[model samples]
Target: MTGNHNAAPTTQNSAADIEMEPFTPHRHEQCRRFQIVSASGLSYEIFVSIPRQAPPPEGFPVLYLLDANADFALADQVLERLSRRPEATGVAPAILVGIGYPETEGYNQPRRHFDLTAGPTRDPFYAKTALTFGGQSAFIAFLQDRLKPLIRSRFPADSRRETILGHSLGGYFVATLATAKPDLFSGYIAISPSIWWDRDGLLASLAVPSPSRPQTIRLYLAAGSQEGETATGEQNAGTQTSAHDALRQRRRMIGNVRDLAERCKAVCRDAVDLRLDIIADEDHSSIFVACLPKALRFTLPFSSAD
Candidate 1:
């Protein structure tokens, strides 16, 4: 059949009639958003949630959450609800700040990889991927130099009560921060931290005394019961039978977390209030939600003696 080449093709439906919903402003009442530019010109979307109750005499404790785009909702809800009933959970009201990228979904993968890892990975598998690593120092500088001051200027944040929460690579960053700059935050929560990164570089670094050590610091470490467990129930199931790299990776993750916790206790026995927890039946992905409540409680304990 001869056809006109310039004519528009016929379709089951017309495209011109479709209409999109008008944009509406939907904001979280408890949260305030801020666009902060770091010294290096990286823009961050920071979401801060102040406590509903009045600040304590010393000012409110601040929880600095990593991977904020993904974790802020859960962390904010948990803190808000638990803080309201401190008698039960022993978690007091505090300021919650989520540090996230400017225009991204749950995570800006490349940025996260670069900003979270302590050093470049030697893993053959990861080496094949295009992802970069070893921007953690710069990211920490941004936090210390720009973000903290911005938050302090706007909120009544208690510098002595600052806490940091991170999971997976974020968790790795938290551990790196703790060892490299112990005095940056008073409390550190590492949930299923990627301790297997960069040939366990972070753990190796922590072996020696940190140049900047805090006299008194609280460290909470946690891993899931099934963190490194295989479908066949083998833990740390290295490449013995199958060639699945994930199994060995998972094993490394679980082992590293435990090892890091023990090392922290041994190294900072006198100065660090280290707590290790393993949530049963939870794996790498599920452990954070399950353990966040406990972590928050530990970080913001009520002054029962008072």
Candidate 2:
């Protein structure tokens, strides 16, 4: 486990356990940038990266990444660094589309909670946290009716090879979308998803084999084994930190995802290509970045050189 200093960094303090805002990386020419308002009137900052090489006849697979403010640069760099030798890595060239907030902060906390959660939030997890919730429907509408159409028309993207990825709360969103609309995308990557959002959690209600989501879905879920354990540091000091830590353990992030993966496996069966990875010593934050390369492989698989 060596660290690359050049790689874009994404981190949120343990203090704001519920909040996810990663360090914004310096913009590079590889990523085209723009701003667009969803029909719901929510403004979003979009970051897109096209392959350096020519696309296949069917076009390149496309990935729609959530929480772009933090992970866009990291994702783009990962694709660029590995895709050069797709035959060996199985991480092929694909269109990278990052969906983020237009606000200046590393992450727009209020907006994200609203955009990521499904329906109204009655989760005890947010008893003390004062953030808005339940706007995923509107956000999904934007992606379907607005952003996606724009991507197809403007880029040589394969309609059937799209993937949607998210971490933490964003991971919660990805998982929710996977079940509610399994046929919406070909692949799903959810890292350290916040399944504690409800008692039965998000996947409790997802009915499978709905005439869609059969044999075409690829799902990869991951969480760090250490995600439930408490860490020692000033950033995690005080009573509030203890409360969150206790909850973290109770919530069982790794187990939650593991259960979801298994459930998806048994229930969906041949309907979905499902995989789960538990990073040995990583935590919630570290697990997201640590698992990106694998996520890409599962979602956008490339044939290995014989």
Candidate 3:
């Protein structure tokens, strides 16, 4: 629904008695949306997709999705479908809550850059872009202090089975969150995370022991096979790779995520079970779509013991 959300509904026909919000409602999903303002008075569009089935006794697990304006529909659809055949797919039905900005259609790039990153710094290449950053902490605060509680209060959310899912910068946000608040969610799905966004050493700090930890730390890091920010190595039989390309590939979206998994494994092996996926034939833009199904599998993983 796109209008003055604070205002009452309206109609233009002289004989019309009522008018409804403009949303084309989903036919099969119990989905709804509303506007919320945070303690800081930042208004957000909260998109929710609830399971059609009743919750389990312990309650349905909740998977919180970032970059909702872009990925929420995908998550909502894939999660609902796979969940229908959980016995085979191993993806249980769960509540999918998308956090997104008001007054945006797709990615609100400016808001995301600030909301998902951890530092005001950037790679030299970005120096010319003059991009501002470093709002992950405040964003996490909104999730922890307000959003999560609101969802739990209103839904049958499984407290012990909460998970976070994101892509790219959103992925970066969750990756950084694991180090600072490892116990905030039971699991994380960071697809093609911009691991290079380490100006403040968020990735490095993963190896550092935290005083607290999640009861179970399952980190699923996925990226496309072609996610290198630039050419990975020398080209054309010893021809020197472009300096800029060489410099840019350092982000090594796939390599860095693998490296991240390895680093966390080395330090928290038993405590943190990690999985990394390099999906074939996808780049950063298409990678998340290709991986969404598998991502859902990870979000509500099958338990062998079960």
lDDT values, one for every candidate: 0.75, 0.76, 0.74
lDDT of 2 by residue, 168-239 (tens): 888888998887788778899999888777527566766474564335688889998777666443245644
Model 3 poorest ten-residue lDDT run: 12-21
- Give one clash count per candidate, in the order shown: 0, 0, 0
lDDT of 1 by residue, 179-216 (tens): 76777888999998877775356766664334466457
Better of 1 and 3 by lDDT: 1
Candidates ranked by lDDT: 2, 1, 3
Model 1, residue 286: distance off in Å is 0.7
Error of 1 at 265 (Å): 1.6
Q: Relative to the unseen true structure, what is the C-alpha lDDT of residue 254 in candidate 3, on a scale of 0 to 100?
A: 75
Using TM-score as the measure, name the better of candidate 2 and candidate 3.
Answer: 2
Model 2, position 252: C-alpha lDDT score: 83
Model 2 segments more than 4 A misplaced: 1-30, 120-125, 199-201, 209-215, 231-242, 304-306
Could you estimate the TM-score for every candidate?
0.83, 0.84, 0.83
- Alpha-carbon shift of residue 22 in model 2 (angstroms): 22
* Candidate ranking (TM-score, best to worst): 2, 1, 3
> What's model 1's lDDT at 109?
81
